[model samples]
Target: MTISLRSRHRWFSALQQLAQSIPYPLRGLLLGLLLWSTLTSAWINPDPVWQAFAPESAIAALGKLLFNGTLWPHIGASLQRVAVGLLAAIAVGVPVGLLFGLVPMIERSASGALQFIRMISPLSWMPIAVMAFGIGDLPVYFLLAIAAVWPILLSTSSGTAAVNHKLLLLARSLCATRSETIRRIVIPAIVPQILVGVRLAIGTIWIVLVPAEMLGVSSGLGYFILDTRDRIAYNELTAVLLAIGIIGCALDWSLQFLQKYWQPSR
Candidate 1:
């Protein structure tokens, strides 16, 4: 038993050391290569998803058109919708999270309804949102807000509830006001956990951004993809697919950077 325990300890230590040693940019490059390989594999042999890597000139020309000619409009439109929806979700979710997590009775009251509602996908809300909010940006915003809200809410609540009992007592002993204790002690202590939720929310937003843009939105990566396919510009489509992936990865990387900075002190 002692030998087995020691071996496990050594193994865990080695893994920790290795994880710390791996540089972020190299890791990102490797991940990008993996993504490219997976996506282009069929094309290497003649697959529909990939027509060809093709000539650099043709690909470059198509890419140039995609960038300056038509793609920008679509991308801009989608980004705006994603930004608006996510910000709205954060506005609503964080406050609700604080309420539930701090008040057990409130949490209990909300638990059943929240769980039931969350099981329904944001996409599932599409028909209703479209009807209620109308065809354009509203529907897209509705979907994104639905998709991103849950993680932030759950994380904030958990973080707030998980506040150290000793810290709570310390605050009490200091005769801190309710608002002051929450502002200083609770918010700071829970920030790391909340940051984790924010990271998750960013990832979800990225994935849903295109899909959300699909709901009759005139511009965005999703709209561009559909338009490219409709025009049968397969190579350009592939390039744009690659570009979208790159953008998504960059967004995730930025979130990770922010998360590291946002990490709460123990």
Candidate 2:
């Protein structure tokens, strides 16, 4: 009994030291580890959901999928849609955002309509998208663009409105033309906000891409998920879901690195 108490005390002390070593935000990871340990004991049966997450089964599924050469194309297709949709959103959103920001009258005139459209969920337009664009990348692109544009537009407009009035006055006093003022001062001032908006838009676009891809597209992670379900490949389905989560996290982290590296404050 004394030896067992000593072992428990040492274990708790180690855990306490670990908790103190890491940041508060990552402490949840310790909880997740505890939950995983408990689940491992309870997951002895080959229940599809439990077995799907078993590390050995997950690894096997990943290996089989990779060896079959069936995975890369879906990932590539989804990435292509994301790239196209993000670019389109940025192209149209930035100019409109700038216009809305610089001109209060225009923003005021369009605010109600913008808000109304913004409130409409992108998924709700799936049927109309298919009917209009007719069952292809076009429909998926339309949904992604609609989902991503609002954040960029709103952020750009807010950033533009928040530009320092005194700086603008200084530019005007120096006889700077409107175009020069915008090019030099306005664009530079709002770049941080633009990056933030892009980050937000990227996250939104990635999320919408999955379900949007399910709209009759032949190839994508979403389609693969459906395929796995139809074929009853639950382990592979779980592997794909895990892959999506990991890839999505990687993309978000890459964007965060860009934002931090390019941001003025360092």
Best by lDDT: 2
Q: Global lDDT of each model?
A: 0.79, 0.87
Please list the residue runs of candidate 1 whose C-alpha ends up more than 4 Å from where it truly belongs after superposition: 1-63, 66-69, 263-266
What TM-score does each of the candidates earn? 0.79, 0.87
Residue 57 of model 2 has an lDDT of 68
What is candidate 1's local distance difference test score? 0.79
Which residue pairs in model 2 clash with each other?
Answer: none
Q: Which residue pairs collide, candidate 1?
A: 74-219, 74-220
RMSD of 2: 2.9
Q: So what's the TM-score on candidate 1?
A: 0.79
lDDT of 1 by residue, 1-266 (tens): 99999999999999999977989988887787666666566645465545354334235745786667666666677668777887988998888999988898999987999999999877888889888998788888888888889999999999999999898899999999899999989989888777777778878877877767777877778888788779888777766776777677877787778777774664
Off by over 4 Å in 2: 1-11, 22-30, 33-50, 53-56
Backbone clashes for every candidate come to: 2, 0
